[model samples]
Target: MPLNIDWRQILLHLFNFCILAIALYFLLYKPVKNFMAKRSARYEEEAAESAKLKAEAEELKKQYSDKLTNADAEIEAKRSEALHELHDYREKLVSEAEQEAGEIVEKAKKDASRERKKIIDGAGKEIADMVGAAAEKVVLGSTADAYDAFLNAAEKSIEKEENEIK
Candidate 1:
């Protein structure tokens, strides 16, 4: 009253402001806050899922890289094994060929020796028959001295034939 202040009007205006604040809190502020909270939670979940997917992709990539590295090693090992097998096969073939060749050479030598022996025996028999026939003819046609001379001549001819055959 002294400063022209009206207590009743001030109290009425304060009460009206309090009612408006409570209405706004329930009608607009609370719903907006809840919507924001839900949106933040959704974003966090999506971020976590994205991170998990990234980690899985990285793990898969690492596994594939390791497989590729192992593949190279496996390829090299297979190649080495194949080469070694080929080398061994070549050696085995060579050894077999050499053995076969040696056997053939040995057989050829035996055949040649057998043929030489047969030829020598045939020549010796032929020479003996010829000398006997000559001695018989000389004895039938002439005297004992002529027979001795014919035997000496036949002996000389046989020696010459043997030398020529050799």
Candidate 2:
């Protein structure tokens, strides 16, 4: 051996290093690379699924928003319609009340007029009877003259009532 180094030992050590490198590549490197590739593929698939779900959620939100807007408009329209109906009902009630009051007033006037006529007729009859008695006392004769006076007085009362009516 030159300078205390052996060629056979050097060759053996190089062969051992090559074997260790090849074994480690087969055992550790191949498996780690396969795991990384499968993990990246799974993450990409998950991202695509998440995007699809987000789009669906956005669509649902838009639909809900539109429905809410339409509902608000519908509610406003219904409220206005109800107010109009209430106003119309109130007007109808007021007009009906006014009409009823007018009718009652007219009826009261008619009743009062009839009562006045009855009183006047009664007073006229009493006056005619008093005139008949006076004429009997004055004439001191047949009752036929008193009857004629009573008839005359009753005719005058009837004439007055007719003139007043005109």
Candidate 3:
């Protein structure tokens, strides 16, 4: 046999290698590649769904935050309104109390004045009666003209005092 390569043998080996490569591609490589592609697609779809759910969660969180802020503002407003109402109520009560106190004082003053006038009139009548009795006894021995003169002076003095009081 010659050491030189045979063309026919070389051609046969090249043809057999082509057939084996084709067979491996169709039997193993194609199916593995297709499965890998399907797995990648599934992963990408899951990632997209996760992102969408995350965005939805963020929106919900923002909505709840806004609601909480609004509730706080409303509570503050209501508290302020209540405080204003309380202040007004306190002022009204104080005003009414002062007015009632003033009225009571005025009534007391009027009552006191009436009582004083009654006491003064009673004292004056008693004094006049006592003086008349004394004058009658003292003037019993006097002449009728002298007695009448004394009585007239006493009546004039009483009238003058009464006029001053009035």
- Candidate lDDT (C-alpha), each: 0.85, 0.86, 0.84
| TM-score of candidate 2 on Cα atoms, chains taken together | 0.59
* CA displacement after TM-score superposition, residue 58 of candidate 3 (Å): 0.5
43-156, model 2: which lDDT tens digit per residue? 999999999999999999999999999999999999999999999999999999999999999999998799778868876777967676867656797677767777777777
Model 1 steric clash total:
0
Leading candidate by TM-score: 3
Superposed model 1: Cα runs more than 4 Å off:
1-11, 121-166
Write down the worst ten-residue block by lDDT for model 2: 128-137
lDDT per residue for candidate 1 within 1-166, as digits (tens), equals 8888899989998999999999999999999999999999999999999999999999999999999999999999999999999999999999999999999999999987887787678667766676676677676766566567656766776686577557
Q: What is the lDDT of residue 126 in candidate 3?
A: 58
Pairwise lDDT winner, candidates 1 and 2 = 2
How many residue pairs clash in each candidate at the backbone level? 0, 0, 0
Tell me the lDDT of model 1 at 117: 87
